[model samples]
Target: YIDFYNNNRIHSALGYLTPAEYYQQSILQNVA
Candidate 1:
């Protein structure tokens, strides 16, 4: 599923985090 890939699939280029996960974590880091 699209949601699964964007929010759950791991990508090595992203340190094994999904695209959505990486984006969310980055945003949180930026805000802190």
Candidate 2:
């Protein structure tokens, strides 16, 4: 359930991205 919430569910507040996707994008942006 937790995994599905973070990795599969899309969130409008995060621009329709899953929480995991949003976090990964932010990490990559910071690394670059």
Candidate 3:
């Protein structure tokens, strides 16, 4: 059972990346 909004979810508003991925990318971009 998965909570679609909380897990295994990809957001189109974030360019189709998962929330975790989107956050990680933002951090990397800021650091670089």
Compose the digit string of candidate 2's lDDT tens values, residues 1-32.
99988999999999999999999999999999
TM-score of each: 0.71, 0.88, 0.74
Clashes of each: 0, 0, 0
**Which one wins on lDDT?**
2
True-vs-predicted CA distance for residue 24, candidate 2, Å: 0.3
* RMSD per model, one decimal: 1.1, 0.5, 2.9
lDDT of each: 0.93, 0.97, 0.79
- TM-score of candidate 2 on Cα atoms, chains taken together: 0.88
Per-residue lDDT tens digits of candidate 1, residues 1-32?
A: 99888988899999999999899999999999
- In candidate 3, where is summed lDDT lowest over 10 consecutive residues? 1-10
- Residue-level lDDT tens digits of model 3 in 1-32: 44566346888999998777788899999999
- Cα lDDT of candidate 2 equals 0.97
